[model samples]
Target: MIIAEQKPIQEIKAMIAGYQKVLIVGCDTCVTICMAGGRKEVGIIASCLRMALQIDRKKPQLIEDCIQRQCEWEFVDTLKDKVDGVDAILSSACGVGVQALAERFPNKPVYPALNTTFMGMPNEHGLWVENCRGCGNCGLGRFGGICPIARCSKGLLNGPCGGSQNGKCEVSKEMDCGWQLIYGRLKTLNQLDQLEDILLPKDWSTDRDKGQRKMFRGDVYYEQTV
Candidate 1:
């Protein structure tokens, strides 16, 4: 999931300082799970803005709404009429959501209310840890299900660096050495010999860094379009 965090109240206020009317848009997907941008979060932010504007003796018109997804046109289209009267839009969704709104409503000014963090999973009820970097190629098969590209600080493909000590990484005491975890996992599976196979250096060009990434499923494409 794409993990994100809401921007500070002060910063958000500043962004809409000049606008007399504003719309707070939220997404019900990834950002919602992270408690960053969702219907609940949208209400909180809207109320906060209302109070803040009142304190400033400014009657700012604030409207709040949440969509099933801000990345899809169908979801965003629902706001067409509501957005028409708003001076600006404050997107509480992920970066993609903010951009999608901007693209959909070219004339309206759109601002981000959260900082897009990373692709992560909830480690617990309130904690989320980074999982994937969205590297174009995946090598989980070779690494015992551990992702060296994202878990390792240096994204080393071969093995643990000298910085690993007792399964922990030198970069941070809280982080487990990704390669160490791979080794242990493979050892437990009686597949430790796989480690002997040196992995070739990653071809980064094939990954996200190359450019905008896209995937197409012909069946789904036609069905959705139709």
Candidate 2:
């Protein structure tokens, strides 16, 4: 899932300064699981913003709403009525959702209230760690399911750097050595021999370097411009 952090109140304050009627839109899916832009969070932010704006002697009407998602066109299209009544939108969704609103509405000013952090999952309560870079390629089989490109401090493809000691990376004692985890996983699977195999240089063209990635369906005449 895509993890996001909510922007501070002061920054959001400056966004809707001139707009009299502002809508605080939340995404109920990815941002919800990450505890940043859910319906509950939307209410919390709206209350905070209301207080902040009131103190400034600028009382803007805040309308709070949460949709199933703010990324897909189908989900975003549902906000047409609410958006028509607002001067600006303070989106609790990620940057993609903000852009979707900007493109869909074309005239309304949409501001992002959350910073899109990364594609990761929660490791513990209130703690989310990045696990994948979404490089558009999968090489987990050779590394026993651990991704050296993302987990490794140096992004080493072959083996652990000499900088590691006692399962902890030299980068920090709190950080686990990526290769150490891989070695343990491979040992458990009886695939330690796979470590000897050299992996070729990663093909990064499959990544976001090319710009404007898209997905489509051959069975249907539709393309998703992501």
Q: What is the C-alpha RMSD of each candidate to the true structure, in Å?
A: 1.8, 2.3
The sequence of per-residue lDDT tens digits that candidate 2 reaches over residues 1-226 is 9999999999989988889999999999999999999999999999999999999998989999999989998999999999999999999998888998999999999999999999889999899988998888889888999988889999899999999899999999999999999999999999999988898888989889999788767898656587
Local error of candidate 1 at residue 226 (angstroms): 11
**What is the C-alpha local distance difference test score of candidate 2?**
0.92
Off by over 4 Å in 1: 222-226
lDDT of 1 at 5: 97
Clashes of each: 0, 0
lDDT of 1: 0.93
Q: What is the C-alpha lDDT of each candidate?
A: 0.93, 0.92
lDDT (10s digit) by residue, model 1, range 1-226: 9999999888999999899899999999999999999999999998988888789888888998999999999999999999999999999999999999999999999999999999999999999999898887888999999999889998998898999998999999999999999999999899999988887777888686757988888866765455
Estimate TM-scores for all models. Answer: 0.94, 0.95
